[model samples]
Target: MNARTPRLEEVASLAGVSTATVSRFLNNPAMVAQQTAQRVQAAIVETGYLPNLNAGALASNRSRLIAALVPDIAQSIFNDTMEAMIEQLSADGNSVVMSLTGPDNRRLEAQIDAALSRRVDAIILTGIVSDLETRKRLKSQSATVIETWGLPEDPIDVAVGFSHAAVGREMARFLHGRGYRRPHLVVPRSGRSQARASSFAEHWMADGGEQPSILEVNIPSHFGQGRLAFRGLTDLEHRPDVVVCGSDWIAQGLLVEAQAAGVRVPDQLAVTGFGNLRLAGDMRPTITSVDIDGARIASEVHRILRARAAGEVLPSSLVDVGFRIIARESA
Candidate 1:
């Protein structure tokens, strides 16, 4: 309790243990003897020492702290992926933490900066960071920088994501092959949607299909937007026979809207979505779209970190978890 004493060091001294031993006890409790750990804990409580964990991590050269940063937690796709990764990674040995960066902001860069300041063991970032300074800082820190959700041209370290371009190209080919001449696109103005929407438009035009109408909406909230787009699309001079969405929830809303108007799916207005979430198949007619396997994404990210920690050289910068075109009654 001395005013001049260092926090964790004071507690360690009070427990008759070296600072390194106390650090190990905090990072890996299994390495410390029960009696010694009890003594350290008692000393910590008596001295009111919370331990400068960041300083301890810097001195040890390993934090054993893994952080996953998401652009927005409100998005279900990321919610599922992060949930799976956290549960699985925590089960193995690492201490996993989360940072919810507001959707489509530079918050990811700031969070990554903070993580590097503490020298976290691993950092999994969802979505792309476009800043050059940020990339340089990331490379300098050289922490296990993993880009998830959105694939980057040059990953800071490793990447795990489905190709939005491929998904778009495939959707165009699928609906066009089925003789749906008019397939309009609905996507959010953020994240992967921009890529998906732009690629879909490009590929659809290149495939000799008409320059289909495009509508942008707030993503991860696509269901309600889909409902609104449904009426908008149907009222067009030449109504779209098919609708491709940035997410399954969006497509589901379109289907629900069509049904209420007694419009038969596929027969009248076809619907398709991306992400192929768990509930996609449980819908009345089962949503048909590109399936991005969330579980697989989680596992790959885990392996990347574990492999690096094992001192194994990873041969690839980006690992593609390919998507499948799941055809259902919708399209």
Candidate 2:
């Protein structure tokens, strides 16, 4: 006298169709005849059968899943791009699974393995894969791979981002043009910031400028670290006339510390940061920053993914979103 759970067979029996026909209706209603699909839908409603998506995926060879691996979700620098990508993917009926692997290549590889095990259709990775083993494993996999932040000359698959090297050179040029010599660089200990810092140093030297003092803080650039970096720069024999921070959070911190120390901005010291974060404009003596359009990066990512999904060959695998140096009161 107990009610039993309904099965696909029961739904198929009620719909007066074979199990294959019912499955076609459930997985892709458009593939089935309209009248037949309606009959299967009515049977599904009557029998209260829940289609197992895993089973459906096995049959159709699609999980409808996309995995996105970011370094840190707490950083607002990546939030805009993440949010925009998620919104667009959701609208297209794809589920995004986000995993934070920090900047550790081993951890990122593990996450990639897990995503591949789950049979994800695509993967969005932040920055280039520097680890050879990880890159090899990724290349061996069949999933569609996309590396963001900036398109590399040779990408794993497809890449969408601005050039960190270009950004660094631009920062150096911008400060040099403003008559700010004796520049100092503050960056996180690891990750793409290193590339920016290196490029900045190279450009500074090429311009016949003396070697700038580069301060490497702990991983994950933050306001507190910015303060520490500023203090460290102050300890140098000859203090820098201008400080270029890797991100706005750090630049803003430097500004706050400068104000507290009675140091006048732009007059006594100049400051600039990358990312052009939202708070950049909100800060007093608004921050000078290099702006990369996160929304546009996300849009391009979506477009490339859509094209790949449709089995269309892309003319180019790399897309350069470019960067902008916004001159503000601070520099």
Candidate 3:
């Protein structure tokens, strides 16, 4: 015969506390006195009591569950933000469920539906929802929707991000200031990367520089693609004097390939990259890159959720944390 499943009442009895007190402690430990909470925790462990979160959610009308959707987990750029957000949410007694939406709008919509069916309190998106129907459904839902990585002109509920176009334009100006005239951009075909590439090209031309060349690589750009991009650029009759990459991974690949080909960095070919990842500074001639504060974005998301939970209205729905150019040896 199987042992009976432990009960909440049994835990309360063992802890010398009422069932209501046990329930309060389970829902929010901060509500109970420290000593009492410790006793309740000890009793819970002894009885192996597991609270039914579904029942608690029904009674409280809040799931304390958050769903986070990202385009690609293989891209390490999202790691910092995700780690910080998960840490903050966990501290608040909330659990996070993550899903990869990829490039398909239908897949994204289906994931949202699944999260809603579970009665999640909030939905966090790595990027703005571009699909009209999906946006409408999210706007209609009671869940607090937050978009990160890029600021949308019309957010569903809240947005925390910087301007991709601004980053591109600033990079172009920075390169121009360093006297790099013949520049080439190696970027992924993704939407955000394309946005930056377009802005960079426009800004470069407007600032009296020649029309910059562009090479569109596959999405989720890798180091190999960067090396391939370098070869392609070098094969051209008019080789570029400088190369700007969409990511640090690509930049690192290019740097390694250039070194193998006996090309002096900066002196012969200047290089720059986006996302000031650790490798950017650690690599041999260090890469100049764009810096986005992933932690700040996560903190803003947590702040908005906390404020909403308290029934407080924020002064603004959009929070632009901004980006900066970290000039290093490569540029």
- Across 182-290, the per-residue lDDT of candidate 1 in tens digits comes to 8888878775787887888898899898788888886446578878989888567788888888788888888899899999988988898887876679887888978
The model with the greatest TM-score is: 3
Q: Candidate 3: misplaced stretches above 4 Å?
A: 9-21, 29-39, 103-106
TM-scores for every predicted model: 0.81, 0.86, 0.92
RMSD of 1: 4.9
Clashes of each: 0, 1, 0
TM-score, cand. 3 vs. native: 0.92
Better of 1 and 3 by TM-score: 3
Q: Per-model C-alpha lDDT, please?
A: 0.81, 0.86, 0.90
Candidate 2 overall Cα lDDT vs. reference? 0.86
Q: Candidates 1 and 3: which is better by lDDT? A: 3
Local error of candidate 2 at 92, Å? 1.0
Better of 1 and 2 by lDDT: 2
In terms of lDDT, the poorest run of 10 residues in model 2 is: 22-31
Candidate 1: where is the Cα deviation over 4 Å? 1-59
